[model samples]
Target: MERAGIDGFVYQGPVRVSPIGTHALYEGQARFIQLQFLSFALEDAPNLAGWRQKGMLDGEYGEAFDAFLEITGAVPSEIDDPAVALFMLILDIAINPSRGFPIQIESFENFLIDVDAGIRFVRLCQAARDEKQVLSLITEYSFTQYAEAADILTSSCGYDHPLAVIEHIVEWQEHSPVAKLMEEKRGFTYDLSNIVVRVMSSHFLAFCDDKLSRPEFFCWPGAWMTGARASQDITNLFLKHLSLFTDKADDDGIFPRAIPGVSEENAVKTLTAFYANVINYDLVRQWILSDGPFNYEFGWLTSKHSKEDMTNSTKQAFQHAFGASPDSFTYTWAEVK
Candidate 1:
């Protein structure tokens, strides 16, 4: 009869908590409930124990189930008994580190029913389209809520992971009405190069100087390039857009206009350093200084430049423009690629 902590419930007798009630529980409590239910189900349901003995609940699947719970906050108590039982089976075939679990027809119908219920609950609780509300939704486990959070971040905050989330949503809900609507509205084709370009352009215009707080602009391109399902279109688009910043050079040397909270010199240097790190020095030099268009038709540039070369180039660029690197200027990019 443990207290449910933030959910303000105590397990009484042999009665199980409803999925709706489980949803109200805090993460740790929810995890406890899931484990408790799983253990009970395993003892009562011989099929589950048989499946577990058959390597269906191996360490890998167990770890993935843990992660799934972490991300989606799903509790066994929240899903139908049949669905929960089926999920253990699906976990054996699903749950890869890189590619994620593919939707298996055997369990997905019940999974979707649970997902829809979570979505309705989240939507009902949503107060507004502000950052707080959006973040809360994103932190939820339901597919629709995750997608909606990504969309809100993209449209309102100019955050860039929405594309990845949308891709996942499309895969999971390929035949759903919502998925169809998203495909029609967002053109959820595998080709995301054009969308990346447009979104990056808008993000640069909107939040270039605010990169300290929202470094997603810098990291996102690399993320897309690394994870892009298509070809080199993403890489090409990134180089092309980065070239635009190079084109912003003035007598002051690459002074991006209208960026706030920093001098033009610092902004240029930070951005240049970021580009050097992501694209390599040879490509940066070619795209920034060369008069020709970047030949992204090919993959990474053939010209070999060491990390030292890129670092020195960045320092030289800063020194030439600002006489010295700014002592306190600090900007970082996520290691997405």
Candidate 2:
């Protein structure tokens, strides 16, 4: 496939591990599970089956499923087990799929099921949230204890909260000890890689639920970069990254290590260079930077420079902000675009 020019990080297989926990790794795993559950649950539903059959699950569906497997190494049976139902609840609320798979909860009975299971899962989510707020789990809490809670939440019937439950969870996380620790620690001690994994997982969930769009993936790369501004700087970094490559090149050929961070001049230079290498970058750039579905994926980040609409200039601007090079590497345009 690489030789054939079909490489662009396409989704692969199933979960290899269990999908429940308070650790950052678990957070990533849960998000993957939720994304897959959302995609498959909706795709498999009786009502939405027809629409899904038309190909809604064809493009990124595998990505979500593969994401689940990558994060949580559970087999297909484990993923589908009734004991793992809480995974469904979190996906339904946080990664609610409306288009390919819509939520049809109209009765108290279904709501009860969700509420019962979600409560526990939400608690685990709360614990994890607190740890994130504090910016350190290994340093502060017992990983075993946190994992135990996560297991209970992931496998039991406590994940039944509506969207409102998320608010409470957030509130709890905010007031929790972990939050204080994170605030106090600030930039002194932070595991950015873990943070990136968590954010990517969350964003991936949002994308699966149709809340987030394709372009938002760019911000994730930036979030993974070093520096405080990486957190605040959101200039549609993904587009610039994508545009940097020519459609005629290999996947790994894109994204050079020497690429600088996003900046004004660098952004324009990168955009011009991408256009020079791959004309299709223009089209993909538009789809990514457009003003559609970003908030659905990026929840809180949209408020700051985080939440933003698409723009024709976004490709250049993003590259400028990141200081990327256009000729760094190459990949076929159709693979990722």
Candidate 3:
């Protein structure tokens, strides 16, 4: 605002999640908060950075940046493997994208499995819990389902819709009211408090729903020894602990398990539903190839694995999607043109 020769506005911290929740619980919360942050940034850059400086945005750097590094409890420098790259992509989508196509959390969960990086995921979850920031603990099974929580925040929380709200700020920036005021008078008071409130509310509501509501137990200290192989494994362990601790489901049965005497038909039905989703991804795939702006990059990121694993795992993913044995696979990441 100084560039516009105006001043006065409020701001809030990145906020935090507690570290005491169950492993499954805190991870869900962390994912949700990350989504809210990403959605807000993608929706509007200028409102936060000011219209005059819309051309640039600051990276999380300096003392605040170092503090974030320290706060994470796991050093950013420690993530130096293929799994780290994938984690970075996931975070990139969560924190930096303009607007990633809506996707399921399991897509992320599965990718962690594909890369053999379940432990890192659990460790992050544990860290959040240790910080006492996770406000909810619900375990959402799919990304689509998790997005439902986002919808609740947009509807119930007083903040503007993440994308639409940001868009409005950008629209206003075209003829920034804050700028016009300064031109008309020697000094003007800009009530950018609205912007600050909206952003804070979005962050607050996301943390509440994802972290505070349904806390879970994470084996942070023993995550390595436990050796859980996938997100699902970590998730199951948390659920099992809950079952043992609570002795039967919560009153509402939010986390339901099968009845022993029931026929296996229900299990088959569940598998069928999953298969339908995999099949439907073909439509999303077609959309990317034909209309997606980042088609080439998407293809490469989705297809490439590490050089250590010569058979690109993404190609194997395609084969598995088609019911073909994933024993062998290969694909080139040549330029899309």
Candidate 4:
């Protein structure tokens, strides 16, 4: 349900059934979903002021990576690689906050969902001569199958095995010949866009399929949500809206009749309006100013910013991994002399 993360990586959501029934005549959205894992994690430390005169390969930060793995354990295991672990530990700190456990997240910001197509489809339905025709108009554009995006993984990413991208990154960073190959391939070609995403998505899924199935975990897709969660609680909100617009085969609500009744005219009209407004949120710039905290689905997204206390944590991880501070990798504030 979330899009990009703090590292600026893209996230493709799990396909879910779109209410209004799978589009019968037209193509419907893909509704199947799989949880995903991204390649990096980062946190920032701004309070310590300084600049490094030289890289210290012998520093404590080098071992910090291992310490992290020892704690989280076995398989959110992508961190098993020293290079990835080090990179994640050293990168710029996270500006937005949220839980980062490979499969859990509760907050995010600046997401944008494009609704132009959805809006157009709604209008077409609204213009239908009658309820039945309205259905046809909407179907011409999309199947009732939950609204899959234009870039479904199977169609966009395909089954080809991905290159050993992580290894390649390590090689490139180490001044190996791989860097030249990547530059040449980039050749400023727009078509090469998202090539990394395809590679990582495939890699992540394969990892999850083979590894992350322990009974102790319940996983889902998306990244550190500053506040909003990835849970049935969220899903239920979606379903609530869906039920308002569409009907089910069985009558489960206590009433024999829909409270307002007749999904044909009024309900369909209301749906058209709802479809037009579901844009993604931008928590920072677009957040509505409120007086004090409110309690509800996304009410926790109130804005706040502060640097993390990564002091010993980062170096400790490096120490645990490499048995040293990884001196050259970490910088200290200009010594007070």
TM-scores of the candidates are 0.21, 0.20, 0.21, 0.15
Error of 2 at 276 (Å): 31
Worst 10 residues of 1 by lDDT: 89-98
User: What is the TM-score (0 to 1) of candidate 1?
Assistant: 0.21
Instruction: For candidate 1, write residues 120-233 as lDDT tens digits.
Output: 223222312234443233221233543454454334422224334324433443466434433422221212223334334334432322322222322222222332222375
Off by over 4 Å in 2: 1-159, 172-250, 253-337
Task: Give the C-alpha miss distance for residue 270 in model 4, angstroms.
Answer: 42
Displacement of residue 155 (Cα, Å) in model 2 is 20
Ordered list by lDDT, greatest first: 1, 2, 3, 4
List model 3 lDDT by residue over 213-282, tens digit each. Answer: 2222121112211223235645644443332111133242112234233234543343333333443355
- Stretches of candidate 1 off by over 4 Å are 1-61, 64-274, 277-303, 320-323, 326-337
Question: lDDT (0-100) at residue 206 of candidate 4?
Answer: 33
Residue-level lDDT of model 4, residues 1-337, one tens digit each, is: 2343333233554432212221311221110011112211223311111111122112333233222234333122222232222212111011111123221233333221111222222222222212222121211111221112111211221211112222222333245443433332222111222333432333333333322221011111222211233446544433322223332345321111232224444433333322222211121112244332221232121112111223333334435544765344333344567
- State the lDDT of candidate 2 residue by residue for 149-231, as single tens digits: 33343333334323323333334435555464344222223233234233333333333332122222221222123233233
Whichever of 1 and 2 has more lDDT, that candidate is 1
